[model samples]
Target: MKTPATPPNEAERLLSLRQSGLLEFDNRQPYDRLTRLAKRLFNVSVAMVNLIDERTQIAKSVDGAVPAVLPRSVSFCGHTILQPEPLVVNDARDDSRFVDNPLVAHENGVRFYAGIPLRLPDGAVVGSFCVVDQTPRDFSAQDLAALSDLAALAEDEFAASCAATTDELTGLINRRGFNQFAAFALSGARRRAEPLTLAWMDLDRFKQINDRFGHSEGDEALKAMANLLRSAFRETDLLVRYGGDEFAVLFADTDEQGAWIAMQYLTEQVAKFNQTGSHPWTLTFSWGICEFDHHHGDLEQWLKEADRKMFSMKQKNSAAR
Candidate 1:
């Protein structure tokens, strides 16, 4: 069996893929529609929209009974992203590259494959839009053109998904993005029996900054808060600008004590920022942490528990002031 070679601009490609926000959100309706269309148009047994990250090939939309995720090394889409043109395998059994591949060697497995690299506007190839069949078949020029057209639509949907999920001011995921991402994150955490913590935070006296220092300064403060969160959290953690001065972080694989330690570091970062005296006002926030309970409730309830704690802290701080 042969494995796909990593792209020369692999780091940049992965960064672009992450920035596209396709992996974070669970809204696959747009991509699903495209895959459905592709399956019918090409008369293929399987059609899928996949995103290749550092280690896994994620199926954002699939029309077949294939696994939602697969290792990048074994994914045909991994090879598809290597080129600008479509990868057409007329017969995998006859091809040396995939003759011994598990997908090809198994009964009723992949015999035909056609995939187009899904590129972002910046020209980084993120993944592939592919169609697979159990029987070998020749691909015509017309077939290739149609597939390309469908892939184009998929790219458009990718851009749209990013815009919808991302906050314009801070580049963090918004509330909608949180809802989609948190659901999946929680599910995975539960299945793996890993500790997952949620931190709900609000900037202290944020409105005062806007009123006294002007809204521009308020924007700057918000951006600084976002930057602080980015610097403090891991890439695997989900950081969100819940709206206005409220922000959130899902500490993946972290319990309440672990989250508290992270928050302590964040508090120090905020203190250091204030010491710089670069701005008229200082950055301070009140936050509350809650560990997820698998048997308890859904994402909404978890969020509410965290928010309630945060609000309680904010009130105590206000009373102290």
Candidate 2:
């Protein structure tokens, strides 16, 4: 089996995909609903919305029995993203590229495949809205047209999801988006029996910065902090502009020690930023982290605890001042 080569502009493609901020979140209702519709309309055993990460293809939404992930080396979607056009493999066994592929050789082999590229707003093909079947079949022009239409619908859903959840000023996840996505993140963590950490952060003396430097400078400060957080944390973590001067980070599958280490890393990054003397004012923040145990009850309770811890730390810092 011949593995597909990476795209020449893979760096830009991955960058655009990351900019969408969809990778940090879980299976959303919009994508799932569309996949379900595609499965029914195409009469396929599997319909999925996939996102191609550097090493894996994540099935962000699926309406069939396929695994949620597959290695990039063997992923049909990987080859599909190389071009703007749909990839139709009528029979994998007849194709040299996939004839000996494990997925093709398995008992539940993939004989029919149709993958329409799911492009971002910038026309970067991140993955595919694809359908698969065990039986070899031919696709008509009408089938391709219908599949393209469904893929377009998936792209529309992505744009809408981003618009609704993204912060206009900072490009971070907004409160509305965080609430929706975090719930899914927590549920997934619980199912996997992994520790999850939530941190509440507030900019120190942010109102003073705004009052002294004007709202424009204050906006820059917020953007600067958002950039720092983005760089410091794992891409999988959910970073949010929770409110004016406030932010939240959800660190999935992290324990308390891991949370502290991340906080320390952020602190070091902030110090380095201050040393640069680029900004008119130094940026500092107070943060509180709570690792969610099953005992934490619900998200509401976990948030409150984190908030309280943050305030307590803020008070101590104030006392030291």
Candidate 3:
């Protein structure tokens, strides 16, 4: 098997594999549509949208009366996956890549193969949505282009599933799906006695924006902030919109001072945004942040401290302005 661009954490390998199966494949989802489309377009006996994990090749969607999770070597997809592009085999028996493979020699007889290697948004060559036929066949330019279009649709579905687990509003880690992840991060932090932050955030004067500018304008401002937050933070950090204008940013492997650097950068950007356009009204927010403390018992204490700090900032700003 080819090595992952990001080294797989073997400790988390099982967890990652389980989640991949859960996230990528749903018989009722767009993947099912792609498999059906593949079968029709190629006129193949078998077509599937698959993801290749370390040990198993899972069919996210399969058509033409086959079950999921075929062995990786039995799959022609294994060879198609090694490089970073599409692999088109007019005749699998003639192609050196699959000439000696069991899928071709045995009664299963995978004579024709074509695969467009699915690249994850992170650039990992995961697997492909491919069509395999028992008879040798060649694809026209139109067929190849149609396959490309269907793969693009599959990519969109994959991205949406991943984005669902995180917060879209504040660009933070969402609570809805992050409980297990939080437990894992917390365990590692406690073991090493490293700093782990779970700071909750609430936008100051957020309600005022809606009250003053109308709700649509308020949504635009929130989305604007969300964009900036996503751009500014490290990929490892979790940013979530807890609810309404409330948010929580978790900074891993950082001290109070390091977080302050990120926080200051965020504050500066928000200040710059406030200066844009001459609409006669501007926007700003109060932020709350705190370091995770094992001595304080649980995550709630950390949130309370962060919330208090944010409320204090808002109060001081209110008095001065």
Candidate 4:
């Protein structure tokens, strides 16, 4: 079997794919009203404001349309990523690109489409402001111009999705958001024949401090650790609390050798915190760094493998002392 061709600009693509801005969009009446206006103004049967990411095309604001996500490759909005101005397909059955698309063959009876490009803050084309129709419809230059205006407004929200994963605690990514980031990072590392590390850190025996000093003190310690973690790592890296004494960081674009060096730096600061704090003991951590591989299976399995290695190293350290 032939392997798939490697995707171009893998890192940039991963970042682009991790975007979920429109996925979180509130399907309110105003959003519906806007798309409905677009459809009626353009004299079309359907309209949708589609946010196109790496794998899926999400209908954030849709009016007079189906309640679903269309596959990214098949969606007419995806073509806007490749173009400068509005993409108008007067008849999908006649267009070479749309002829084989399933949506053209059956679903939605999409005979015509017009999509204007939308961008994120980083200036990446991430979605489109498009109107679709069951019958072939010609768009006047006037309709095209109006959609362009609306496309710019949608781009504003698209830009906000870039920072959607940030954690308020330390301005780091939260647990829920980091999983997608981490996976994409690993995929890039694997594709480029580079190295990436899944680094897991847990404060050694942290429960004793919370038990002795009280939960308020525990909260303080967590905040302190958050600050330290922020300072110790680069802004591009992802740090997430795995909840209760453990935190995980994905060292994107890093190798095993480099990750190990960083791990030592983390351990030293955690030790210093343990030593200087007024509690009976300072906080220390056990960490495991795993360089990524395509064969590590899914995200859960890869993390488990890293955790096992970390636990093994921790046990060995304890035994040595």
Best by TM-score: 1
Q: Measured by TM-score, how close is model 3 to the native structure?
A: 0.50
Per residue, candidate 3 scores C-alpha lDDT tens digits across 1-321 of 222232244335334434433332233467887888789877899888777776667888889766587777566676666765677888877877677776677676888878887755555666787888889998888988888888888877766655466554444455544554667777888899999866555676778889998977777776776776777788888776655676667889877778878988988877787787744356577776778776655655666788898888888888988
lDDT of 3: 0.70
Candidate 1 ranges with C-alpha deviation above 4 Å: 165-321
When sorted by lDDT, best at the front, the candidate numbers are 1, 2, 4, 3
Question: How far out, in Å, is residue 160 in model 4?
Answer: 3.6
- Residue range 1-321, candidate 4, lDDT tens digits: 111122355367446544443443343454566787887878777778776666677887888756558777667776776666789989988888777777778866789989987766766666678888898868888878898877776665555554556554445565547766776776776788766678887766678779988866776677777878877887767788755666788887787788888878877877777677565556666778777766645777778978888788778767876
Model 1: lowest-lDDT 10 consecutive positions:
18-27
lDDT of 2 by residue, 1-321 (tens): 888789999999998777576675443788888889999998999999999989999998999998998998999999999887899999999999999988899988999999998988777889899999999999999999998998899899777655578787788988768878988988888899999999899998999989999988998999999999999999989999887888999998899889999999999999999999987889989999999877546988988999999999889887888
Candidate lDDT scores, in order, read 0.90, 0.88, 0.70, 0.71
Q: Pick out the ten consecutive residues of candidate 2 with the lowest summed lDDT.
A: 18-27
lDDT over C-alpha atoms for residue 316 of model 1: 96
For residues 1-321, could you state the per-residue lDDT of candidate 1 as single tens digits?
Answer: 889998899999987776666675567788999999999999999999999999899999999989989999888998999988899999999999999988889998899999999988778999899999999999999999999999999999877766587887788988768878988998899899999999999999999999998988999999999999999989999999987798999999999999999999999999999999989999989999999988876777888899999999999999999
TM-score of each: 0.57, 0.56, 0.50, 0.50
